[model samples]
Structure formats: structure tokens, C-alpha cells
Target: MDGVLVDSETYWHRFEDEWVFAAAIEGGDPAHEEVTGMPYYEIYDYLDREYGTTVTKDEFVAAYQDRAESLYGEDVRLTEGIPALFDSLRAEGRPLAIVSSAPQSWIAIVRERFDLGPLDLVLSAEDIDEPGKPEPHIYERAAAELGAEPADCVVIEDSLNGIEAAVRAGAYTVAFRTTHNAELDLSRAEVVADGPEGLRRVFLGSE
Candidate 1:
């Protein structure tokens, strides 16, 4: 529900730039391009590995939580045409969901802040025992929760990892452009849209 359904990735980059990565020494923070579509724990793992961190993984996670709550609480906004997009999907009886790398709580926060529409399912990377996105578990597990196999569902993904996961799950994926992940190839996805507006046609199979 973040970069896909809301224009929150930029602000999230702010959090990464300011807090989660601020205390680290120079060159320690993740570059914008490095983290697009990556899972939260992976974010922590990358920082821990690259930064020469004395901080425990748990502490880093905690710090990120504190800063994220403060950051996204104020700035997140719904993606353009989301209400129209979901309304159209609902009319078609499509089962829509959010499968994310963020914690369940972060997902909830975004939903409340954006007043997200009804969703058939929502799953977090932490909920599944298998690996995160690009590994097929997060999206595949969400598909299972919908009582549909992965091929039956279509995914709206904005990150490379999410696209890989969706493709591996046998689901159609639509990629959204963002500052970080733009050049990442999404040719394997069923479609790639410049933004959410391009997704309307995919939902209707019009283009």
C-alpha cells in the first residue's frame, strides 16, 4: 500500500536518509537505488553489513520503527487515481490485496493515513516463515490467503524485488515508476505503467 497505492516512497527515503541511516558514518546509508522494493529486514541487514555497525539488529529495527512512525505519520499521500482504480477493480469482482515488506503495523498506519479502500487480503513479510519478496513467499502467501493460487491474482508492484516475487508466483505484475527503482528492468512483468493511471487499462484488459 505504499509506493504502489500511495506516494510514500519518497518520504520513506527521507526517513532512511534522516534517521535510520543518519547516525551511521559517511557513506553508510543506503543509496536510493539500492533499496527500492527491498524488504524491511533486508534494509536492516544491508545497513548492518555495510555500516560497520556496533548496534544490534534489534536496536536498528527499533530505531527505524520510532523514526518511521514519526515520518510517515505526517507525509504519506494516496496514489493518484487509487480510489478510481480500486473502485473499478471492485466492480469487476477482482480480489485485491497488499503484500508488503513493511511490518503489519506500518501497513496499518498507511491504510489509516490514506483511508485505503477495502482489500481482500494483506500480508507482511514477517508473517511467513519463508523468505521475503524476490523469493515468492510474500505474494504467494497473500494469494493463498485469498484462496486463490498465485496465477489467479495480479500484482501491482513498484520495486524490482516485488516484481521478481510476483513473477515467480506466476502472477501478472504491473510496475510503478519511482525515483529509486526506475531503471530496474520489469520486462518480465505482465505490464509496466508509467504510473497508476496506466494501470487502469491493465485491470480492464483494454491495452
Candidate 2:
């Protein structure tokens, strides 16, 4: 949801650069991709395991929660043409969902703020006990929740970890290009879409 539904990646990356990478993590500076698509709690775990953490898990989570209140509630903007695209897909009788590594609270903020709802499902990593992105379990759970097989789903993601998760889930993944991911490799995805307009072309056959 960070990049696909709302332009939250920029805000998130800023936080990572200013605080997470600089102050919270120890030793080497980890790449943003290393933790971008994992749940915030899982991010702390990953960092602690890989680079060692300077802050306690509670402190790290609190910092992210504090930043998220403003980032999702105020800073992020909805993806251009998304509402219209949702309408178009709805008209075609396609089931719609949002599968994200974000917690349900953060997803709720974005959904309520943008009035994007009446969706078939809004699955968050917090909703399942399984590991988050880069692991196929979340996407697999999302597909199951939608009453479909993983191979029958079409997942749109803007992070390498997210794409990897979907691809591993056996879905046809679309790598969405955004300012935050332009330099990241997205080759594992079955399709790469340049932007919101590219998304329209992929799902609606128009741009």
C-alpha cells in the first residue's frame, strides 16, 4: 500500500534515512530495500539479526508508530487515478483487495482518509501470524482470504520484497515503478508498470 495505493514510500524512506539507518541501526548501513516491505515489528527483528539494533524493539516500534501517524494521516497522497481505476475494475466484476505489510491501523488510516473502501478484502500483515513480505505466506493468505488460489491472483507491488513475495506465491506480479523504486531491480515481476497510467493500461487496457 505504501507505493501502490498511496505515495507513502517517500515519507517512509525519509524516516529510514534520517533516523532508522542513522541512529537505530548499528554497524553497516542496511539498504532501504532490506526492510521496506516488511512489517515494522519484523523490520526491527530483521535489523537486529542482520546489523544489530541500537534501540529496543519497543522504542523502534514507537518511533515508527509516531512517524506513521503523520505520514499516513497527512503526508501521503493517493495514487493518481486510483479511484477511477477501482471503479473500472469493480464494474468488470473483479474482486478487489489491498495486501500490505503495513499494520491494520496504518491501512485503516489510509483507507478512511482516502475513502477507499467497499473492497473485497483489506489484508494486513498484522492480520495473519505468518511472516511478512519476501515470504510468500502473506500473499498466500491473502489469496486464500479472497477464496482464490495464489496462482489465480494478480498482485501489484512497488517494492522488491513485495514482488518477490507475490512471485513466490505464484501470482502474476506487476512491479509498479515509483520515485522511490526507480533504481531498485524489479525483474522478478511478470510485468513492470511505469506509473499510475501504466497501472491503468495493465488492468483497464487504457491509459
TM-score of each: 0.86, 0.98
Residue-wise C-alpha lDDT for candidate 1, range 45-106, written one tens digit per residue: 66666766556777877776876685568766777788877778789888778888888888
> Could you list the CA RMSD of all candidates, in the order they appear?
2.5, 0.7
Any idea what lDDT model 2 has? 0.92
Alpha-carbon runs more than 4 Å astray in model 1? 19-22, 25-30, 205-207
In model 2, what lDDT does residue 83 have? 95
Please write out the lDDT profile of model 2 over residues 1-115, one tens digit for every residue.
8899999989999999999989998889788898888899999999999999999999999999999999999999999999999999999999999999888899999999999
Please report how far candidate 2 places residue 66 from its true position, in Å.
0.7
TM-score of 1: 0.86
Q: After superposition, how far is residue 101 of candidate 2 from its true place, in Å?
A: 0.8
Best by lDDT: 2
After TM-score superposition, the amount by which residue 68's alpha carbon in candidate 2 deviates from its true location, in angstroms, is 0.6
Name the regions of candidate 2 deviating beyond 4 angstroms: none
Give Cα-based local distance difference scores for all models.
0.75, 0.92
